[model samples]
Target: MPGTPGKGEEMASDLSQSLPKRTFKYQSSLPPLPVPSLENSLSKYLEAVRPFASEDEFKATVQIVRKFQDGVGKVLHYKLLQRAKTKKNWLEEWWFDTAYLEVRIPSQLNVNFGGPGPYLEHCWPPAEGTCLERASLLIWHTLQYWNLLLTERLAPQKAGKTPLDMDQFRMLFCTCKVPGVMKDTIHNYFKTEREGPCPSHLAVMCHGRIFTFDALCDGEILTPPELLRQLRFVKDRCEGEPEGDGVAALTSEERTRWAKAREHLINIDPHNKTILETIQSSLFIISLDETKPYSTPENYTNMTLEALTGNPTLRWGDKSYNLLVFSDGTFGSNCDHAPYDAMVLVSMCWYVDQQLRLTDGKWKSTLMQTVIDCGNVHFVR
Candidate 1:
């Protein structure tokens, strides 16, 4: 398969489009997480294990815990204190590695978190014949949110007067994880206006195929009409060709296996390496799903399940976020667990949902509050 596009090839490429790269960034403020005292931790552990322990087991555990608390635990606790003195957040790195990057399992089934957009069904229900239109609209709104952060126009989130950490927001876009044999590493391409350029491109997948274009043109975000044209081009291209090689499925493989496969793929063709980097550095993905996952205002299980477990070929499991746009006019997201805080994703979803509610679920022009009516549906160009 060297120098030839055939079996085991990286199917994500071949449209052969290119664009100028752009940059992005954000701000954050949060205190270090407090470490619990050893006595408090030990008592909680004992409480949790009581159900599994009989009277004798419980008594023996108490004796062992008392001895360890005075002996090994004291020394370990001192080490933890030393670690805390050296690191602002002693547990952060350990949690990241143990909970996600170091796990060798398939990320799709184990690490990624997928769910329906917050209250999305209310504004954009599962209506037929509205996939592409609504998708373009949604993408435009998402870019607007990204723009807020990029321009530093959005205020730092706060709880009362204290600023909550907004670090995860920056990682929500233009971020990805590269697989390693023992540990995966996050490649965040976002940079502050002062830090210089970050990627402004967007990658979209249709029928297991990927096509990318810069989300911004001439230092400005693309309008919804422009995005629709680009999406339509990808869809049309897919219709004319056979099913793609579905190489993205490899991302769902065991981390070590995926790392090895990726290495072989790159060695087979240098272009394969470029395509992989393009995907990793681009803004999060948009998956154009053909399946109609029925969902409504109250329940999003169908949509959520499909987003989490649908076509592995359509999802780049290591990306920080993969927006799933179903043919039934529903939307959900599959996000990596690295910058895996829920509130970061939730705040953006919540913002877009509110925007939709304000406009009564109609697509509106960026310059005005109203939309141009066309064929019983409102549109913005």
Candidate 2:
């Protein structure tokens, strides 16, 4: 007879067997993201520019567009067609490179998405002195959601029963934009169910200091108690120590400026590049904010603005997600728009919000927990 299973073992077995194959099951059969025809694109472009262009400017633009459409555009279209023949999703790479990497603007206001926390509605009202506890629980739920994505257990996203494209969901974790002189590139360490070994480390930011530790220990995600211990250790050290230089600010600068600064930084010290690599390779950033509560309707608006742009000191604007934990136990997120759209983060946040609601934002751990020592990452500048 088989031995009786422990609670954890039984839970794991049930989860593995009960999860439906919904998330990426239909990805292969879904149509490729479409490319607009040159004529349609040019016509739409002209229409869009009409309000901004003078009559002479409009005429000149129209002539130029027509000439290009008849000349170089045909060749470009042919090339695109030829390329599409061999590629499963011909537009995906080009869209990513052009729409995100090549844009040389400040990404904080322009490319990052920020939103208010839903916990204010239920399961943990804005309460003082609960930030750390709430953050620990949020992080635990986040890791569980990440595991769902990794294991292909999350329900497939759809549009009225039709499966929508899920390619962007891959960038939700273990992704960051690497700065370049002319264009930045995304470094995505996330893998599909078939692909193996996504990065398991989580990066935490507090008091202008950044630290990273493995979220997984002994092949299981660290319990909320363990996460709380680690988070508290970082928070306590940050409180005691003077602030770090907040080198992450460079990421908020204009792309080219940041790229140049990054180059200089790397040249100044080889370790700088390694630190950048470490951050880029981590799953996501957890920002431990020390802001006081502003939970009123009017205050919520201010809080949203602050969350969107508040402290560059502790944020890595290029990372796909930055979960902000306020001192009042409220939360918010800033997400880079390059790798994925807002909906991917929205879905993840929604999942966590629902989970928190179900459990009253409390962890159900029984282990005897002690503070785990957290180490800070130092850059020689």
Q: Clashes in model 1: which pairs?
A: 22-198, 23-197, 23-198
Off by over 4 Å in 1: 1-30, 118-120, 366-381
Scanning candidate 2 in windows of ten residues, the lowest lDDT window is 1-10
Model 2: C-alpha RMSD to truth? 4.6
Estimate, for each residue in 1-381, the C-alpha lDDT of model 2 and write its tens digit: 001222123223223355566568898898765668999999999999999999999999999999999999999999998888888789878888878889898987787888778787777777898889888888877877777778777777778988888778888999998888899988899985567778888888887788888887656677677788778878888889899888888889999999999999889988889888889988899888888656763457856876789889878999999888888888888888998888888888787887777676776544444444432233223
Query: Would you list the C-alpha lDDT of every candidate in the order shown?
Result: 0.75, 0.79
Each prediction's Cα RMSD?
A: 10.4, 4.6
Top lDDT model: 2
Question: Candidate 2 — which residues are off by over 4 angstroms?
Answer: 1-17, 35-80, 297-299, 365-381
Clashes in each model (backbone N, CA, C under 3 Å)?
Answer: 3, 2
